[model samples]
Target: MHVVAHTEQPLQAHALIRAAASQPALLPLAQQLTDQCWGLLPGVHRLRFALRGDVPQNTHPASPPLTRDRLSLTLCVGPHADWPEFAEVLRAHTTGACETPVELAALQARIVTIIGAGVAGAGTARALAERGWQVTVLDAGQAPAAGASGLPVGVVAPHTSHDDSGVSRLSRAGLRLMEQTMRELLIEGVDWGCTGVRERRLPGKTRRAGVPLSWLNEHAHTANDWTHKAPPPAPDDAFWHPRGAWLKPAPLVRALLAHPNIHWQGNAKVEALRFIPHEAHLSHASTNTARWQVLQGSTVLAESSRVVLAAGPGSAALIATATEDGSAPRINPLRGQISWGLMADLPSGAHMPATPVNGHGSFVHKLASPEGPAWYTGATYDRIHGDARLLDSDHAENLERLKALEPDTAAALAPLFATVGSDAPRVHGWAGVRCGVHDRLPMMGRVPHAPEGLYMNTAMGSRGLTLALLCGELLAAQWHGEPLPVEGRLAQFLSATRFRSNA
Candidate 1:
């Protein structure tokens, strides 16, 4: 539902004419946008429209409601040389509101410091950088995605429930954003793929009730694009996700960190964070000069008027350091291991899946790797302690889960597990620890009980690839007062303060 159009002439002079000629019905909206478009600056501008329909509104909550564009229009007023800057930039300029807010005119420093170089931090850094913010990403590791996002390969798919839960809707929005980012950045087959996934629902795996409401029935066709029935041993429980994709998290993280406005500083582990107040003066009496200082012992690593803490498992301790109450949200470490091997290692006539499959555990086949074209599966989840090391017991656990997810494929690959003596396809294991909260949703927005500029984007659990990009966009949208990428109600679920409201 995205379109790209270019214009070489004076945009303001002929915008209405072009719009009016093509879609006469939208003349009024075009005129409204044109009239409010006063700043013809040499940068990016977003003019939004909230167009409501004349159709009858839904009377009850049981039936699904039909919605319209929740519209937006972007205009780049610059020369050809500046097209690249204008095209990629998305500033929260114009308020995108009916009545523009005056506060947006008076601005603070645009520099922001993001702690973490994984998908969560890099994603947020990229979102802010695209909006003209100078972003500094700090990481304890030698390079980015060294944490849980270091998973060799992962899947992106929408979550579904009988009632269409908040996580379900938010996941769909995340997948859309992920796809958009992949198209803009990363290699198609090597870094990622939109190859549809087949999900096999098994006993005690599917979350559903006895009956589905009319709301589900009404959106079935639209949902088909995201997920649809696929023929399998149990057709009723099987679903095919057209938008689903296999993603190499490290590559995407690197791409996000590659934005011109983002500067990455590795091995700069933040020991503590403190909000330093600016001294009042007669010449400059504003409170905008205050900054959050990132500290390691006595040395200050960096300082910014705005700060985002996306350090994954390291976020809780940082929040506790900065907050007055000395309390932080409960983010527990969930360790997991994924098993993989080269495709060439498999013996002749070995069963191979055409596409990725997910249910009890996920199996991604024929993905490009340093060794060769490889297949991956397993990812046993366990409570984390100290370091998350790859275990032989966990490898056995993965094989058992694979047996349930794809019995034929698991049976075929079972021999490879014992190929330790020979140079045959040997099973390799990778383990990492992912953080999560009591509620499955990610923790986003400004950190409660903390300083004004302090924010958080973490605890994505196993949905890092699926939701990280969207979380970054959501954080940037909330910061810039832009229209949310997802519904407003669904966004409230991700608020960092949802569990600590009193704080």
Candidate 2:
């Protein structure tokens, strides 16, 4: 539980420092300390930072608040017996410099460490380690899931492309493996239940005649009788699912980190990756290690042979060195915002079927909440060039789309707009971003030109909870040189090669 102040290297510390120092208001204060700290410890092997404070300012009422007031920060440096002198330098530079740098750094690392942090990188590393690969996951955020993987709840489904489409096929295979992985992995308090997913059928035959479409435009009805206390006897003509599940994404992430084989260091951001014939060189925010190091302010944290860029969309920006014909993997960031509501008027004992209402890529699910009859109605997919802003217009558009799918349900669930009796039951919602691959399937293979030891298991797009387990297993198999569970051709469905093929 105690996250060491310094790891085998310094990259982790460096990332933590840069992220903190980059703050506009904090930059000036940090710069003064960094210049002095780095100069004094030219031979310093590591730097650590820890901050305790009140939350940050927030203009929007719903946005997560930032920490502010009564803050404490710690910085730790290695190879320096006189850390007090170094600590004095940081104290002189800050306003409330009560705590010494080294003292605080160790405390912060231990606090954050014991709480159990790190997201995709940690999860992947843990999985690989269970399979016997010594893995160290590097992250830039103070905590994992700070990036795109931070959604409170994520849609879980087996997405299919047009019939026999490569992505669809891959999704099917992935779904099967995912089911198996969930069973094998022990994730606690992670509510996972299968509800068949569906793409709704056209309302009536007449409406189908007017639309022109691509192969993805299959006119189909998706039916789940969970609306009624007793599902209508299987409609011979209805489309329904026998399997689907709701997953708590955060808990799933924590479960992935529980394995013994993986070691993780949060805030270890990688800026540049230099590929050698055998190993890859990582550039940390704090250290100029000949190899890699963690840094805080102007210090280093840790380093290792393998680094997985599981920072979601941010990985795209950091992986500029792995270009193929002027392009890295064709990963794009898609922002999805969703709203939640409580169906106050619905009949009791209504089983909320976990099926998707398609055509607009919107998905819905029912979750147990203290508030009555809560449902997750969301997700408008908007392609933004690195924008994480939760726009008001996006929310309105999502609500409008929901109206079209189930007008009565939309109207019955309208209380999210204002204060209502707490006992009446309402839906509370959230929005998040999903990392998508150009091929519409997840990218989960080793980076071709990078070191043979390096691998990538990200680009999960919209289905992280459903796909993460399966993708982890697939990657683990590849690492072991064992035959794949899915077919070879299907494996290519998820390859980075899609970034090149004109198709």
Candidate 3:
């Protein structure tokens, strides 16, 4: 069982006083409890107390072992304690673990239908499948990572702010979780590289001036690395993140969807959702069994009591249809294009930086590919453009931005441009549309007022590579009634209900 200790201000002392005043026989024990717990750290602690005559004192062999039950107490001893998060944790522990309808019929198998086969959908599939639920993922694309997640290499790093905003904290937590996941699932150095990242500050930006560099070092820096000192070849003002890395999303998505309980159906476009109520002849108890149907045009594609909409820009339309509310949160489609070139084209001793660098545009070092060693750089962002077709103009725009960001690297590639012409490098690139909510945060949790079984986990923008796994875990935790991996405030910030008028 869980209990929250009244450790705020005079509450601790007041509890002790009330206990002693009400029961004079327990005065000594109440005083001892106060002395032992009044100054503990701010975290969950286990407490045990022996009650007189609670167990027999006999030492017989057949006598049951001393019966002991552990009490989990959440202690907050400082003014900075997150009360809302503490309350949520307390609620989860006290209410027991297990979601509603899934546990209603314990003998029957549970099934969940997830739409979309990108990172978000694949990650959610893995989470649910690991919990013994049969999950089937449907996607309109021919294969997974056929959307924004199809990027060859994407950076995974924590965001930092002077005030440590919600986005920063969430990204920090997400980065840690992603790092742990990569270690467990993907092959090191091949599928992912923890080569660290360098963030170059703009010429006039001063938001991070007064912030202590130690904060970044403590949170994301390795033991051997120190903050405030730029590594060789990078600008002196560039901030280094030792824990940052570059990941290949396709492999990660495939690995996540490889679970035995997960099934994938490609080229299956989900057109609409329907909530089918139980028939009148069915028993009242079975009425609580929710049913959702996934439709493609007039054809029924799939159905289950649980459904998750994670199809990026396509989720907004589905949500609007499912909830029958046209005012659902708007997910904007933002087009992005990334340019790449063969690393062998550069001069043999060219000063190509070993790590990924982020400034006006980002550059990734040589990564092994089927063709040969390749380098990625310049993902031009255009919010007004929604077209998925690749453009030579966009590729040129990427190279231009890269030239401004790293002049030396651009100069070193002059030979390649001379040999193959500038247009050759611009032709090799990829383009995709990324989804973004109006608030610029991911939309997660149950769809607002839509049935209990309907949910969403999309609109991740460009951070899908960094935030998808953690958000998936968060959704799974809520669905299973498990302790959340992130704080309650962060979860609420990304909640689907945030778009509701009454919320």
Per TM-score, the best of the predicted structures is 1
lDDT (10s digit) by residue, model 2, range 1-503? 00113212223445555775878766643553353232111112211122233333535443334332112123343433534443443343333323233422322121111112324454566556654455555566676566655665544554432233454444544454444344445342244555555444345511221111222122221111111111354322233334444555555565666666555566665555543232225454333222322233445344443445566776665455533433356678888776666556455544444454443444555555456545666677888645666655665666677666555555555445333334542334466667777556777666655443345667877766655555665565454433343444656666654455422
**Which 10 consecutive positions of candidate 2 have the poorest summed lDDT?**
221-230
lDDT (Cα atoms) of all candidates against the true structure: 0.75, 0.47, 0.70
> How does each model score on TM-score?
0.79, 0.59, 0.77
| lDDT, model 3, position 284 | 66
lDDT of 1 by residue, 1-503 (tens): 11112344334435644565466555655555555443222333334444454423335443334345334444444465555533333322222112223433334668899999999999999988976799999999999998998999998887876666788767876776687678668999989998988887877864542212532465454446667667665347677887899999999999999988999999988999999866556356455476799999989999887889999989999999999998888888888988888889888888777788887789998888898899999788888453568777777888888888888889998988776335653998898889988887899989988867799999999888888878888898777655456545667898888884523
Instruction: List where candidate 3 sits over 4 angstroms from the true fold.
Output: 1-109, 204-233, 284-288, 414-427, 500-503
lDDT of 3 by residue, 1-503 (tens): 22444355434444644665476555544443453342122222223233333432335443334433322233443343556665655554445422343543442347899998888999999878876789999999999888888888889876665665677667765776677668768998899998888777666522343223444544232212312335666776677777789999989988989988999999998889998865556676555456889999889899788899999988888887788454456789988888777876677787777688776678887798887888887687788877777776776676677676677887776555443335454237778888987777888888885766788999998788878877887898677654565556778888878865622
Q: What TM-score number comes out for model 2?
A: 0.59
Tell me which of candidates 1 and 2 scores higher on TM-score.
Answer: 1
Report the error of model 3 at residue 86, Å.
3.8
User: What are the runs in model 1 whose C-alpha is more than 4 Å off?
Assistant: 1-107, 209-216, 232-236, 281-288, 419-425, 501-503
Best-to-worst order by TM-score is 1, 3, 2
Backbone collisions counted per model:
0, 46, 0
